[model samples]
Target: MKGRQIILDQINGREAAALMVDGQLDDLLVEGDAPRPGTIYRAVADRPVKGQGGMFLKTPDGNVFLRQVKGLAPGDVMLVQVTGYAEPGKAIPVTQKVLFKSRYVIVTPDAPGINVSRSIHEEDERDRILEVAHEVSREEGVGLILRSACEGADRDEIAEDIANMLDLAEQVLADAEGAAEKLLDGDGPHLAAWRDWSEPAEVVTEAGSFDTHGVLDALEDAQGSRVSLESGVSLFVEPTRALVAVDVNTGGDTSPAAGTKANFAAARALPRALRVRGLGGQVVLDLAPMPKKDRRGFESALRSAFKRDPIDTTLVGWTPLGHFELQRKKARQELREVLK
Candidate 1:
């Protein structure tokens, strides 16, 4: 369990796009931008089309949503920060931005009647905290995330973050106005994800070229764990939705009483293996299902086969098909430590 770095961005919605790690959102990036974010709502006097509000339309990129309607008005600013990555090459998928949805108090007087009516989703509230972050990102009329960094944080800390965000947003506005184009907010989702993962694990790279020191520091600060790196651990990946198969190499733990011994061992190690491998949900262990009769029968033989790691085996009783039923935790991604 090592902390890694990830990136983050505000994409189609207010949510930051990212992949779910341990049921947590990591890696985010903003995908598209309106042609204009703070232009005044000047109604066309002579011949205006119906429903046209002179609003700046952030051009839609691909179907991947990294955009959101923050209801910004002229002079109103939106703040963004560029975060880093969960692991090298583990870029946040722009299409999955919806995974990080949140609701905030939005003030859009120009919209006439649009108010913050929807209640916040539990998942968002549970994951992120609203701190003085609101102030740092204030532009009069905009919505933004009170990132997980603010969760349980002191009021002073929140306020400081908010101020920082506001300052950053103002700078972005200045650049956009002068450029008259879609201004890129140097900070995006990628960096955010990187910072989040830097917690709980150390980020190691094969080559020393991709050094993101600032991202690692920010992640270490946001989270209270040290990130480190390891070497010589080879990772193999196999993409399969089929049932996961774990084979234990006991190198001949088998003896005259090996059947019962192996079964007991597998029952003990099985759980740990499942957790380490990040396997879960409905798992078909394919172990020997029947009773062993003094640990030397067919049951004993089956147990010996998987006993090396047996803690994970929860004999969910037996199944109608005479097959043994067991459940393992589901992992969001390929388990990097299954073999180890």
Candidate 2:
């Protein structure tokens, strides 16, 4: 099939929304997003925190830290990767190590070798994918790690993604400039998806007939309340200023087996919903009560589902209260507000 066509449009006056006209697929929204994670921000080490053991590094956005820059002097400017968002009184966490994200690869400065995702268990396919990845950055510069998304991707797709990443690296190097300040803005949920898709895309200025995507409505809705599923289960996605809590509730008549099925479905949809909504950072998924045997199966289902997520999500295992812990790195504003 030929590459898909993408249309990017401004829905509200200030919000930018994009979609693939290959039948008005999912809408990609990315306006007024902030503190994009996985970016290299050039900042200077500022005054030391008295009892925190780490001094704040000041950037254009604000002061962020990781444990204070070693050998950091007041005037020394350092390159940091934004890890999380900054709350009312809390600074965003940052680190010296930088990871460059692409549609199919993650390039980092820490490792000099090319590493493929473990999901590609087939040894021959893994070698071929790695070879293609190496070809992308071998002569140009650093190595890149293949992401799970590249599992079934063709060489053309992989090559194109790598080229886009290499282009970004070039842009960053050129834009680094003589002075120091955030070197890269990085890609938020929308921009990253748009660029990665790279199919023939168009930007629509007016709604017209693309309303079928439901992305517009999803973006505009801000109730952020509990949503009921057809399986007689309810999902409550609550996002605080710094973290997100998802509570799963089953109906009174729901049987344990049915509840297990609903919870598994919820686990699969949770990350997709969060990514589409642009919700990020620490997340806790409180599933419906289940027996110990079922809990193991439910956790396996979660891990399987998250394997397809483009965002960096870490399943931190089940809590004593049976809540599933997750740490997805995202800093974009919620879709609820983005639509507003």
Candidate 3:
């Protein structure tokens, strides 16, 4: 309970994985019905929306909408990858850029280069990983990216991962001429946990691990709109049809710095709240009443907090009415929707 622990369990007979750190739930992944991001497909081009500059494509799953529709024509066949979950009653979001990602390596079919993650800065380690990449017999245009997890990894494991990804990329790229069909299925919760959570942790795969590890309780708390920060400060994170609205409350604190303290706490806790709820898209924060001079500090705090988060989020700055805004990617389905 002191260190990181991964609990693999079933919620409502659906596959789910929970990451717990120091007896608290840090992250959660639950299976959903939408096509998972990173799935590859050989799709046939459908009609284009003239003003929107987007094109619809016919896939085995259904019709998907692709952006940046330059140099694509109707009836043309091409390969695409699912980018993220689509809104309700909307086409699945996709992109022409496809990538084969794994724990230690990512295969880039379009970009051509061998690069190591910047986190591994030692020259000797970088050189060793580069040599391992060079040993793989990849095609001319396909590129290789050595992830940060490759640092200090076994040579054989790195080489094997690279080789496996190259083979899979070659196979998928070769089958681009077929009808609209799925070329590859994305990784499920268990596999995704293995791929992304590379750090050493205790693994629990027994039945009812969620209850045993307190993940169920954490999830139950995440389902509510109120999140308690520190010193009786709390915030309400509610999702509306258009955006997520966060209202901060200072509670019973009546000190001169109460508003500032509450706002800063909200800034630090907002990312985790949104992440656990799997809420994304536009977000508006109605922070506690604070002086204008403290706005810079609040912005800095928010930016630093989001920088450590895994999901892609953009701090879109403050509005005219003193509301802070953010734009987050739809990386996961809404927790309420998934549960229902």
Per-model TM values vs. the true structure: 0.28, 0.74, 0.97
Q: Write the per-residue lDDT of candidate 2 for residues 1-340, one digit (tens) a residue.
A: 1324344445555435445443323435566645767667777777887777777877888778767445777767667788766554678788776777876887665466778888679998898898787677753346677876787779988988887876776566455433457787766545665546544455444553235544455444424556656657778889887689898877764564766877877886676567656777789887876677888888888889888665678888877777788988765556666666
Per-residue lDDT for 38 in model 1? 21
The Cα local distance difference test for each model comes to 0.33, 0.68, 0.92
Backbone clashes in candidate 2 total 8
Say which candidate scores most in lDDT: 3
The worst-scoring run of ten residues by lDDT in candidate 3 lies at 136-145
Sort all candidates by TM-score, best to worst. Answer: 3, 2, 1
Model 3 lDDT tens row, 1-340: 5999999998998899988989877888889999998899999999998998999999999999998899889999999999888877789999988999999999998799999999899999999999999998457888888998998999999999999999999999999997899999988888888888888899999999899889989999999999998899999999998899999999999999999999999998888899889998899999999999999999999999998788999999989999999999888889998888
Of models 2 and 3, which has the larger lDDT? 3
Over the stretch 146-189, how does candidate 1's per-residue lDDT look in tens digits?
A: 44444444666556544554454445444433212323423233
* Model 1 poorest ten-residue lDDT run: 92-101
Q: Model 1, residue 162: what's the lDDT?
A: 49
Candidate 2 local Cα displacement, residue 286, angstroms: 3.7
Q: Candidate 1: misplaced stretches above 4 Å?
A: 1-195, 198-206, 209-243, 247-251, 255-283, 288-340
Best of the candidates, TM-score: 3
